[model samples]
Target: MSASDNKIVNQENKNSADIITWREYEALRNEMRREFRTNDDELKSTVDEIKQTLDATNVTVTGLSDQMTDIQRNIADMRLAIENLTVLQQQQQEDDDDPELEDDAHNARGAPRGHRPRGWVPLGRNGRGQDEEDGLGKPKFSIPKFEGGADVEEYLTWELKIEKLWSLHPHYSEDRKIKLASSEFDGYALRWWDSLVRNLDEDGAQPIRTWRAMKEAMTSRFVPTNYMRNIFDKLTLLRQGVKTVDEYYMEMEMLMQRGRVRESLEMTMQRFLNGLKYDVKGIVRHYTYTNMNQLLHHAREAESQLAEEAKVKGRATGAGRFTPRSFYSAGAFDALHSLLYSA
Candidate 1:
């Protein structure tokens, strides 16, 4: 009886122990699963935060790129504007012939009334810078009287002076310009203008309303018909003569400008060559010259060389006159031999 009871009790005890072990193992597995779920949720939240940060960063980068592009475009527009302004300034300089009218007499806005600075003169109703209050100041300059004449040079000089004066006072109206120039006319020129005006009124034609029209009328009447032909004839017969190369070149250039003659570089060079003295031209023709300046430079060298040779010959002849006669010289011996043979 005791052995069996003890065996049964032991079996029951073992079964209880096995049940307890299984319960503990099940509780541990459930705890581990809950911990894994918590960790997985935290990882998902972290990943979402990282994705949001990347999206914000991308938007910021795109905005910065657009701003950079706009800045570049603005810079290009500014550069183009500078280039155009520079071109305009250069053209203005060329047209004005570097006149002293570049300084501003007053501000961009009109000057206050009754402010007259030193060396500043008021514009005139009849002519430039006459004593009158036009509310503007210009540097004082004189316009010469044209007074019609047979001297074409006089007319040309007067016209040039008028044009330069007008360039200084570009704000002048066309009618003002015509009247200002007409006021300076005297002698035959005044009579011509008066006669032209009367003829215009009689024909009911508009009088010379612009400076350009006035110039055309005056030039046609004052410039002789054969004046241009005379210039051409002189050019055709022009030669260096006693003048130096520089003098000849300047005269030729002046004549060409007066005639408004345009020629190819080769043709101009040939004309210049043909006008040179024979000795200089012979040396210059043998050399290769591409431009007129080069030709002129070579011609001058040739002239100088010829001049030096002539000076040396003069010096040698003078020295020989001072020295005693040398009968042993080849030329003297030949002469002496000829004389003896003829005798």
Candidate 2:
């Protein structure tokens, strides 16, 4: 129990307390570091997950945008198709509503009850013909007959007769007496029973059969020469000659309108000027005239002046050029005037 022993004990006790505090502080620091590490790892995992989710979201958004664009395009295409179909339907309906250009028989017959004329066929119902089964009526018109394979005139006449016969009657049975149109044949329909022969060439009227084909052949054969002949005749015969300026212009103008000249307006005007009686043409051309109206106006003025000058010259001398009042021309008057004046 001395003072020194007490001091030593106190020192040991302080040392033990310091050692305990150091241990506790070290443990707390270690635990805090572990917790910080755990928090950092958790934060890193969360960040990584968020990054993956963002990448996936970007991909999904891009796909959706592309899909939306494609959907928009498809919608646009559908709208256009619908609009076109609507317009086409409307036009078809309009055309359906419009009356057909035909004989009044279409209206006089009245509206159809069903898809077709109701009941038995009219020609059968009346029992008018020799056979009710056949649609043939009394033959009001006769076929003028044809041997076929002829010139344009003969062929044309024969074709017209066939047309007339078909137009007059609704049907004709194929016999020696009469023949009908057929699709199985080269031409039209066969109203009667089957042919005994399979490949019998139904000569419905050969060399020219179908109306279109016949017309085409006829036009090619006959029209070209006739067209040329007309042009030649017009050119040879049509002349201004002694006609007045207005008369000549009007004649040429009429011919021009009728497409007789088949040339440009300038060329036509040139032809008309060439054909004119020289005196009117010369003075009119001397003036500035770009078109027909101006040309006609100037020509009339010049013609009047020529007539007046001719009248003056005729009074002074005995002879002259062309004039309405007298048979005097400016050219002859000029010569006579020069002869007398020179003397």
Candidate 3:
């Protein structure tokens, strides 16, 4: 009876222990599931934070890309600007090289192809038709164009025409034309020409007011200067030598200017005709020339023909001067030589 009771009690105790262990195991399993759930939630939060960081980094990268694109555009614009500036500099350099665009103050570097130089443009502002300051800082005046002349009135007239072309301002008066007309000529007269000049008044002490007055004064004192003495002298002396017709005519024109004489075209033509040598004058004397230009043209033509005739004569002399008697003489000698050989 005691052993059965003890065995049953032990079994009941064992069953109770098993029930307690089962309940503890169930609680541990619930706690482990809660811890796992908490860890998974923390991991999910870390993943979300990483995703947010990646999104922010992507946004920054997009902004940087936009900035880089802007930088590239700015660089391209600068390159374009530099290229345009280079083109402008090249254009300016080309303009500077152009003859027409060269500084007008330089005038011409040298005379035109075949023509003799007109006048040397003095260095600096002197040749720009500008008023120059003298040593004492005073305004120095000079004739714009006075090569050299004996006739004061004609010379002044020519200078006035040049002044008009330059549109130069005059020192004397506000009006350029009136100032030129009233310019003093006595000061500019050369020694060779002025030596013969005599004053107008009885005492000859007073200065003339203008060039016109000076000219009138001279006219009274030196009307043609010994009558036709100088005129006839020049006409007789004038002759065209090796100089071209233009050069010859220029010399005659200068003579005319010196004498203060203006002849009609016909009178000039006759003067030129009378001055020529025998052969040349004879050819020109027959034509009733209306203009000196026409006479010069015909005279040049005759001169050319005479030159050709002389050249033909020279050629004929050169070809036949020391030649043998005939080509037939050489042939006769050859025939005699053959006959001798045959004998």
lDDT of each: 0.77, 0.56, 0.59
Candidate 3: residue 1 lDDT (0-100): 64
What tens digits encode model 2's per-residue C-alpha lDDT throughout 76-155? Answer: 77976886566445434433343431222254356565433333223223322123233222344554644333243444
TM-scores, all models, native as reference = 0.50, 0.29, 0.36
CA lDDT, candidate 3, residue 22: 70
Clash number for model 2? Answer: 10
Off by over 4 Å in 2: 1-224, 236-238, 257-260, 316-343
- Lowest lDDT sum, 10 consecutive residues, model 2, at 183-192
For model 3, residues 1-343, the per-residue Cα lDDT tens digits are 6999999999999998776577889999999999999999999999999999999999999999999999998997797688656644543454345443244324455556554444332333433222211111112354444334455455546554645543643322222322333343344444323443333344545435344554455455434455446665875689887766567778787667656567777778777776665676677666666777788887877777777999999999888764445655668767877899999
Best by TM-score: 1
Q: In candidate 3, what residue range of length 10 has the lowest lDDT sum?
A: 130-139
